[model samples]
Target: MYDIRKLVQEIDKEHYLNELEAKSKKSKKDIQQKMDKINKQIEVLKTRKKKFINMLADEKIKHDEYLEMVEDNNNELAQLVEKKNEMLSMLESEQVIDNIDKLKQELLQFLNFNELTPAILHHPINRIDVKEGGTRVINYRFAAPTFE
Candidate 1:
């Protein structure tokens, strides 16, 4: 049998999770915006390339001029597509920092909880210290592990 008490000895706050969420939201937003911009540029380039074809068919421009414009459009499209791919890769990498969810899922495997409700448990109290002037310090057994 799985011991939930040992599995969940302490509830720790995911400090980096919050910070990463904020950063990733902004990063993802920024990357999405850039991708959208690239898509629009690609569409514009396609439209321009089509216009060049129409112009060539209509004999409105010389063959050399039309070919040059089409070549330029292709070059710009290639560059934009490359940049877009880089942005997509960055977005994928940004999602790699998901340890908090992994930890949550692991804990959830042993416990079923939807929300926090009041509970009375004395096992969590490790000890109570009485000092001078009747001052008391209550030490809890379940606490976030401290790091040096």
Candidate 2:
């Protein structure tokens, strides 16, 4: 008889790896898009600041109002810069990659076990549905495998 535990573990690991790859790609892309948006906003604020300076030099606006505008723009620019730096730091860190690698290694170790313990099953499986004629459907905790 086939070892059901081994079969389930194999299936779950394959599904998990695939899901992780897709999710990581999406997350990186999202972060990159946000960074781009922040950069654009920074550029816009810088342009506005320059225009304010030109208006002040030409004496088109009162000095006090120009100073107030410059202060507001500086505050907003500082916040955006801080946010961009944080995002860049996150991109530079290997934490996400390391965590995924660690999980993969742990799952690989499971291959050494001959039988699935309750802990192993519970970690990956959400529920099991039994159908007529002894067929069973497993719902994984993460996501179901896409056969296609």
**Top model number, lDDT:** 2
Work out the TM-score per prediction. 0.59, 0.59
> What's every prediction's RMSD, in angstroms?
13.8, 7.5
- lDDT of predicted model 1: 0.70
lDDT against the true structure, per candidate, is: 0.70, 0.72
Could you give candidate 2's per-residue lDDT for residues 23-142 as a string of tens digits? 666767877898999999999999999999999999999999999999999999999999999888877652443465554455456555789787865765668899999999877544
Clashes of each: 0, 0
Of candidate 2, the 10-residue stretch with the lowest lDDT total is 139-148
Candidate 2 C-alpha error for residue 94, in Å: 6.4
Q: Cα deviation in Å at residue 18, candidate 1?
A: 1.9
